[model samples]
Target chain A: MHRIRCPFCGARDETEFAYRGDATKRRPPDDADEDAFFDYVYRRANPKDWHVEWWHHTGGCRRLVKVVRHTVTHEVHWTGWPDQPPSLPDGAP
Target chain B: MAITVRNGVACCLVLARRGFAEVTAERLELSLEPGRATIGAERCCLPIAPGEWLVLEQWRADGGLRMQLEGDAAGLAYVSDQSHGRQVIRVAGPAARDLLGRGCRLDLHPRKCRPGFCAATSIAEYACALVQVDAVPSFDLVVAAGYAESFWLWLTDHAAMFGYRAAIETVDRP
Candidate 1:
């Protein structure tokens, strides 16, 4: 059972949060070329190691949070507000 | 020994804009801090977020706390009268924590979540703002109006084991 410690609502069951896909993906500037926009919208890397993802605390604070987790082990390193930077996990490259 | 549910307390939600905490504090006459509540003579203000607070006061016949706050701090904060939008239920008794623990994930232990601690969490599938009101383990649950009836039913059903009573009182603001 995974429990996420929400910055606003404290620790809650993982079911309380909805996964919102990759947080590392940045949208291209409006003035950028169509190719850039296409890649930004469609192309995304599925890394095996530590990756940042978006999780919405739908049941609790109803706010979006950025979660850094290890894809292979399903170990969450840190969870923080989307606008804030997530702390790096120990021993992470 | 008994569980009591008190319904219809007046509540107000205050959302302070960026860099407006000082103004809010001055206007509301309560120091604001996340996860902590400042109880005054008339009302209690619980800072649920960095810039958000839930002000709880006794109900009155005339437009209660909402009107009072809007009249005082409408320019400094966004004041919404949640008296009707949400139903305030006070659960007090020796088994209050045990009853709440059936659905809530929060640690209701006096040491960890004593008086003045408020949180937004789920209670029996309904989103609720749970506030510890006193050391008697009394809790005030602010639930959405739409789910209030059903939530009350669920609570009463569970509280039957502990001997519960429902009371609807029109309390005057002090």
Candidate 2:
């Protein structure tokens, strides 16, 4: 099983987790019109190299984390917090 | 000394907390390494995926742990120090197997839920964290803290004829 580190609860088994969705994507400014904000929140392009978010220990600590993964290969290069960008190692798939 | 062959230790001092009671117990002298927490307890050397644990300290009517939880709920993680929200119930002294067998689906035989191992099972119509306290098949059940009074009454009322003499215990107790 893949072990993912959470910003709040440290590393936990993936079984106690749920994939939240793309992490790096941000919504438009809060001042933006309501319709535009709704579109930004709902619409998303399934990109190949995307940042995925995951929640660990749902019943316990309830913290979310991001994983830099390939959509096609389902391979994750690295994981980090929402504010931090995932770092890719050299020649990583 | 009772010899146990298992993955974790049956700590003499079990801390059982229920709903919002703030269950936080500091492991004494546990060695924390870079990525893992190691304990040289009598039963197991705990070092695996996570450093966290479902500590099985007994729940007492005396309120030693309850006072601690109420005093410092902010310092400990909400998962552990939820004494106000959950109930810490003790199921030990021989008939524990029979008491638990009526509810949980897990096998309480020494070959399965042996000393040092903890299981998350359903009891009292809700999910609970159950731990093996001894090889003879005693268990400590960590239930939601809100149900503490009801659970305590259940064990005392139902577990009497089955050979359980309701008594308070600590994790340090052997």
Candidate 3:
């Protein structure tokens, strides 16, 4: 089981958190075209290496946190608040 | 272990003003930090999340605590009475920590879970708030009313293994 470190609450079991989707997605502008909105909603990248995503500390602090995780290894490299960017180590996937 | 199911306690949910600290210090005289509770004689302030707290008190016939908090939180916070919506369970004994560690993922070792340590996490898959009460190694588990019965059943069933005695009392009794 993966242990996620919450920004407010300390590290807790993965069962306490809910996987929010990819954090890289940005919503299209309000006046953007319909195709742009459709693409923004439907399309997503399923990366294999290091990926940036959002995980909600549902059972703990109940806050949205950004996490950098490896898809294949299931290793969480970094975790922080949603406002902060993921800072990965050198040579990290 | 000894377990007491506290009944008729006054519970309040406090959401502090964003970007500033208020209500807790001015009204309750408790300073809140992340994952720590400030305990007073009759009151305990537990941090539920960022800028939020669950204030529990020993209820009296006059219902003064919630009323006073509502009045004091006019523009500072949003206070909701959770007296009937949540249940407080106190577990104490020499083996209290061991009993709780069964389902609690957070480290319950005395070295890490000293008095005033508090966290909002799940125990046995039920979301609840846990706070260390005193050196007796007592812990107060605040759970929602909806999950109280199931949580109690789970607690009692597991507690039986350690030979626990159950009682009913006020929040301050422990």
Candidate 4:
């Protein structure tokens, strides 16, 4: 069983949570073009190395949390709030 | 920081009931009961489909039993411990419907989320559980426990705005 650490509830089994997509998303500027807005809302780059993931703490806390996990190893790099940036690997591609 | 029991109304329940259990293709079976999950024969009888069973431990994935669970489990996919990390808020009374209107997006109708059904969704900007506790319009909100205090405040604050009054009530697993 995969045990995930909920930023609010400590380490818990994966079931008590919901897996949202990547946590890292660009915030379109107020005066950005339609294309930029569409990209921010739709397009995404699924990188392999240290990746940012969005998670919903469905078990207890309702706040959206961001976790940095390795896509391959599934090892958590770090977990933080949505505004926080995910930690990157050395010379990440 | 003070972990205030904000309202002296929360109740701890003796939730000793069988939730859900499953057996995987690996021939691994799992069960989520009240206290904890264990492989094979345990003292308490489970009125469930015959298979492997494990009680849902409302604690962290650590220590002896956890290790047993790790080894015995086909995977942690079957048993879930959604109780610990999240706050469970219960909002009852006639105005319960009105109170939930502000944040909940799912259909709050009784038939939609009837008894014995669980909805895993969000309310406003928070993760929440909407259960119809009473036949006569009472409902419960099982949310991330960490945000319990805030949601409680929000519920009451908006409840007042919605002409509804609420108090903390204890929630136990049965």
Candidate 5:
């Protein structure tokens, strides 16, 4: 099982966490067109390489954490608070 | 090992507001740092999260766990009595760590989780706040009241392999 290092609770089994989907989505402007809104709401990228995502430490601290992970290897590159910018790996896309 | 179901444990959930960590800690006389617990003669404080703690006290005729907490908080934090909403279980004796490690993910090695160290984690799929109370390696698991029976069943069932006896201890009010 993958171990996620929660910023507040340290490393714990992945069973203690709940995956919260992609963290790279950006909201369209308030007055943006319909297509922009549709893309923002429905479109998602399934990258095979490094990706930014959100995870909730539900069983531990119950905090939201932003994670940089390699989808192919299931390697967690880094984990930080939701308010902080993700520090991507050296060769991360 | 011996599994004791501790009843009547006076508990309180204290949540320090942002910027009130120091005041709360000072008033309660217990450090609220994560992974740490302050155990006194009759009182113990286990860290639950950043600025959050689960305070426990041995039940007494004049025990005012909530009153004492509310008084200490003195408008600096939020305090809620959990005496009736949670149950405390004590697992003591040799082989305690080995039995617990069967389901707990955190390394329960002596060097890693020494006495006074506590964690908010899960055991046997049930969320619990665990604290190592002494050098004997006795551990106190505070779990939701609703899950106490089921958790007890699981604990007793698994504890059979290591040879365990059931016991009860009292400490409670509302």
Candidate 6:
């Protein structure tokens, strides 16, 4: 079973969290072109290695956290506040 | 060992304004640490989140802690009186940990979760805020009012194996 280390509630089972979509998706400016907005909302990269995603600690702190994980192995490398970027370690893939 | 469940206690959900958690904590003179509670003679302040605390106290005709919080820190926080919206149950016994472990995932080991520790999680499919009140291996579970009946039934049913007794008490004033 996968466990997530919640900054506020310590490590807990992943079942308590809700997997939000990709955290790497950035929203386009309101004045941006239609295509840009479309891609921002609908397009997402499904990477096999390190990928940033969002997870909501619904059952615990009720906060959104950004997590870097490997898609194939489901290994979570790190988790932090949604507004902050995950700091990758040296020589990390 | 005997397990006892006490139902109905006054509670309030206090949400601090952004960047004002410390201000609110100062006003209440309570610690705002996650997974812990600061107990006073008449009240218990539990920090359920970074900016949220669950204040539990016995009901009083003068409004008790809710009155004091509003009178002092209304500008820095939003206090929602949950006295009627939630039901508080205290479970204590030698088998308390075993019974709670059936639904709770938190490690209830005395060394890991000592007295005054609190957690917001699930129990018997219902959301609950749990607090370890003392070293007697006692715990207080706060569940939504709507689920009170079912949660109570679930608790009593499970507690039967360990031999349990329940008491419904009117709120006490200090």
Q: True contacts preserved, each candidate? A: 0.43, 0.00, 0.90, 0.07, 0.60, 0.67
Per-residue alpha-carbon lDDT of candidate 5 for residues A4-43, written as tens digits (9 for 90 to 100): 8888788889998899899988888999999999988888
Candidate 3, B20-71: lDDT as tens digits: 4554456756556777898988889998788788999888643466687868
Q: lDDT of model 1 at residue B66?
A: 78
Q: Candidate 2 lDDT, tens digit per residue, A1-93?
A: 556655543444456567777565677887989888877788776766544555444533344567776667666667766567668656543
Prediction-by-prediction clash tally: 0, 45, 0, 22, 3, 0
Cα misplacement distance, residue B76 of candidate 3 (Å): 1.4
TM-score of 6: 0.92
Who is ahead in DockQ, 2 or 6? 6
Comparing 1 and 3 on TM-score, the stronger one: 3
Q: Which candidate would rank higher by TM-score, 1 or 6? A: 6
Off by over 4 Å in 4: A1-93, B1-21, B24-84, B162-165, B169-174
The CAPRI classification for model 6 reads as: medium
* DockQ for all candidate structures vs. native: 0.54, 0.07, 0.83, 0.05, 0.72, 0.74
State the local distance difference test value for candidate 2: 0.49
The DockQ-based CAPRI class assigned to model 4 is: incorrect
| Order of the predicted models by DockQ, top scorer first | 3, 6, 5, 1, 2, 4
DockQ of candidate 5, scored on C-alphas against the true complex (2 decimals): 0.72
Candidate 5: stretches off by over 4 Å: A26-37, B61-63, B171-174
Each candidate's TM vs. the true structure? 0.88, 0.46, 0.92, 0.40, 0.92, 0.92
Could you give candidate 2's per-residue lDDT for residues B1-174 as a string of tens digits?
A: 111111111222222233322233343322222212232333222211133444323333334443543354444433333434544555655667777766555456656556655544345555556656555655556666566566666656656567555554433332
Model 3, C-alpha of B120: deviation from truth (Å):
0.3
lDDT of 6: 0.82
For all candidates in order, the CA lDDT equals 0.79, 0.49, 0.85, 0.51, 0.88, 0.82
**lDDT, candidate 5, B28-68, per-residue tens:** 88775789899998999987787888999986544478888
Q: How good is the docking of model 2, as DockQ?
A: 0.07
Model 3 spans with C-alpha error above 4 angstroms: A91-93, B22-27, B61-63, B170-174
